[model samples]
Target: MRRIAVPWGVLALWVAVLALAGPFAGKLGDVQHNRAVDYLPASADSTQVAKIQDRLPGGETTELVLVYHREGGLSSADRAAAAEQVADIDRKLSLVRTPEGVPSRSGDTVMYPVASTGPGQDEKARDAFVNDVRDLAHDTGAGLSVDVGGPGALATDASEVYQSLDGPLLYTTVAVVALLLILIYRSPFLWLVPLAVAGVADFLSMGVAYGLNQAFGTTISGQSQGVMTILVFGAGTDYALLIVARYREELRRFERPYDAMRAALRGCGPAVLASSATVAAGLLCLLAADLNSSRGMGPLGAVGVLCALVAMLTLLPAVLVLLGRRVFWPLVPAFGSRPKERRSLFTAMGSSAGRRPLTVLGVGAVLLGALALGAFALPGSLKQEDSFTDRPDSVVAMRTLAAAYPEASSQPITVIAPTGKATEAVATARDTDGVTDVTRGRSGSGWTEINVVAKAAPQTAAETATIEALRDGLDGRGAYVGGPSAEQLDLKDTNARDRLVVVPIVLAAVLLILVVLLRSLVAPLLLLAAVVAVWGAALGIGGLVFGPLFGFEGTDPGLGLLSFVFLVALGVDYGIFLMHRMREEVLGGAPTGAAALTALRTTGAVIASAGLVLAATFAVLTSMPLVQLVELGFVIAVGVLLDTFLVRTYLVTSASYALGRKVWWPGPLSRRLPGAPAAPPAEEPALTRTP
Candidate 1:
């Protein structure tokens, strides 16, 4: 009666949940803000100027540059073709200002700086306009190459890439998890239960994330949403793996399925709880971030993990109990039937570490340190145009314009000033260092807009200096200088500041949580230090490969901070599982060395599977079209692998063995009783504990 009622109740609850989640989950993609200014730090001058521009007369112009070129030089026919196309664009699109062609010095290229307010402030409408222009330019041009490049085109291209990612990312992630589960379980029927539950968790997360946006005005970006999906499949599957493995073990001890699941949950529940709590607490730390995208990702990601935890802990258990041992089918764990006792890979690894714990620990440390040095080889900060892994039309256009218009501004610097100070601001901008030209446009409410062009190319170091000079020059006149170049500059600076402020906070927060859970100062610090080393080594590996092998131009500014947060948060998860087992064995009266080896032997395979699932999920990002996503995926994936095979398996086990009971310093386990039986030697198996 109990099993029957519980399974039916759990199934019914999930049915109701899916029904409610379907609608909101479908709508989550609709609220994503992928525009350049949308991702900028809130207090940035670029953000302020963009807001002021949005409230102006036309509500921000959709500006573009249409470049026409012939390799040798423009002929009579080329010039005629260029004019006819420009005229068609003006007539069909109804430009806000009719652009006159500006010819290059070599007569090989002509550029038209076209502006239109037909889209107003709607991102979708603006995308449509940019797409239309690109289509016409590509479809109509004859014997001349036409490319549309500017902020508007770049934003549209980026949105298109982001929009396309949802389907492929989901499919690829699901396939990867399914394949891994099939191999690990070696049962044709067993893998689907956990996979299906993970899918439910992912859908639930999407709905909750959408709710977060509507209620709290959380900034939902494509990047954040993509990450949430990965966490659901990755972390959810991890929890499912641990529970199912424990349930199988308990099945051998208990006669009834319900009784077996009860004992299993009681055994593994605290470890799973502590693991998820560490991950959520670390993600919640993202709230202190300055960038809207990074800050918003924290709450949304935490929601994913907690939602997954609920589904795995409640729904998966109920369903598995109802299915009974038959779900294991070809390899069922019957009542009193135990797994074959034999030598395994993890057992062999434990044996090796036992022989020379210090030697094993020292060699592993040196290898990780060597990997850490590769970070110095990484490329510089990634440019906006180089952010995408594939070359979109916008990127191609920008590259072409860069070559065609060297030492000439391809993009303008935007300045917003008080309408009363407009004239004086324009005069100051004109006389400022590095300013080649300035033009005033669009006055409304109490502010005015000015477009200034520097002699240096867009986003070049010289142009960056020019932007700073203008902002400093007009600081007292109620002016804000902003544009693509300024936004990139702000992004770089704010990421540095955010890392300085947030890294320590994340470390301290995760450290506190570990200390609380483990009830030991030395153990938590050791775990934190181990994860930090993994992060460095992983980053260094990325530095060595990202440029020469992957062809990425530069690293994303926020990559370091984000990678640190995730590695420390998620890496500590496996540490918690092992340490919890160790603690359990120790408190149950197992000697220190025996307990450490037993814990390693019992939990090693599960940690390896969980690590593979997690690393594979993040590795899915390496196949994404954005370089930043790819880089993040590579670093995190590599870091997880290192933590699994090297840090968790060997270094941690070695450190535990070498320290004896001292590893749990200040904890009750660290002190031995005066009259207890003599402890077994390190060579003996810890018969007192078993999986």
Candidate 2:
């Protein structure tokens, strides 16, 4: 009765958890934003400009360009229609100034720059304004078309993609993981238990993330939230796999399900805890990053992993115990039953690696190094207009304007200056090289706004030079230079800086955790080296695929850093599982060579299954609309597969076999065991029972 009470009590507590977390889980979407300012650091010039704009008379401006274009040239009727549409927009919306259509040199396109502050910083209102203007800017079927593009329109399109990601991303991830689980367990009922627990963990993570936002003002973005969901399912299912595999083994030895569960926890719980700690610690290192998105992602990711850990350890065990051995269905392990054993694939791999360890290690290193060289083939940093996989109205308008007005920018460079120095600032900006025109407008809270136009197109090197020149010309004059282009510049630069700072921290954090867990210096370094090589190889593969195959024009700025953190942290998990099991065998009086092979034979299937589940979950991101998400997902998914099938299976195992007991250098396991063989056996004996 007492034993039964514990499981029921756990269920009751989880029910209570769901009740508390359900409300906040849905609220997470409310707090998520993908705004430019959200991605920027507080100290960035663009961020400061945005803050000041929010304090201006009407609020931050929603700028747009209504592009009217024709394949040949605009006729009198086309011009008239464009003019009437512009007038209609001006009448319906509160514009900062009366927009005048500027004709392209080609005579095929006319763009009217629209600016309004009425929507302020409200995303919904701003989106409504953009949509309403789009409704007003009608396309005439006879080769005359209209589009609304600008910073405002681009932001709305991005928001829509992000908002759309929540449902599809979650559903797709769940479906992928569910399918993988079903295939792995091959049981009608077994797959549902972990999937349901993962679902609960995801909800719990969302609530905790929302709480973090409310309490600490953590910035939440669609990207970070989506990653959080992936981690919950991927990592949670991994933990479940390890626990269930162990429990199944224990069930054959122990009569009671509760006793079997206790034994299972005793066997694999430390490795699970250590791996989770490693992931959380590595992700927490992102707090040192200068980018708010990266920093906030640190806590959100750590929260996700930790929540998954708790649910897998507590709730999953409780539910499994309640369901008993029946959960295994046709494959149920009966008490005192010795199961038949067949030669496994990992057994063959271990034997081959053991026979020619050096050859295996050398060849694997060469292959990974060769793959790493492909990094040079990767595309340049992604541009804002090229961010989406499917071009939106904003992207179309920007492209049309770029082709039509090749010599000038349709986007404005926004500057905020002290009201006292507004005139001087304007003169400085106008005199700066690359400046085509300057207009002064808006004054409030002691700040004056100036809009500058450059001779070059948006996000190009020439326009970047102009923005730099404006900053250089206006520096220390109590003015801040910013705009969409400036914000992109800041994002690129900040991500580069963040990589420098966060990468080292992540490395040190994960290495330290490994050293502590393994109680050895050499093993930790070996594992870190293997995972880092995996990262480089994974990125190199990305370079090969992203441009040549996927035709992605640009790489996301944050990809390298984010992918490194995830790959290293998550990749080390398989190493920990393998090494931990090997250490257990070594402690149980097995020779070093025999232990390595046995560990591979025991843990390889579980690790491979976990890797597939994780890789598949991340692969779901490839279907997302944004190129950034797709790139990130592709690289990570590829990395996990490489780690699982190659690095863990071949390189690390080979290295361990070659190193012998010395793999545990300085630890007690490093010492020669009593009566152990002087060297590892040339071939290992086949086991009689399932490991």
lDDT of 1 by residue, 212-312 (tens): 99999899988999999999999999999999888888888999989988888877887898899999999999989998888998998899899999999
Give the Å shift of residue 313 in candidate 1: 0.5
Cα shift from native, residue 253, model 2 (Å) = 0.9
Model 2 has an lDDT value of 0.90
What are the per-residue Cα lDDT tens digits for candidate 2 across 145-173? 99999999999999988988999999999
- The superposed Cα distance between candidate 2 and the true structure at residue 189, in angstroms, equals 0.7
What TM value does model 1 have? 0.97
> How good is model 2 by TM-score?
0.97
Residue pairs with backbone overlap in model 2: none
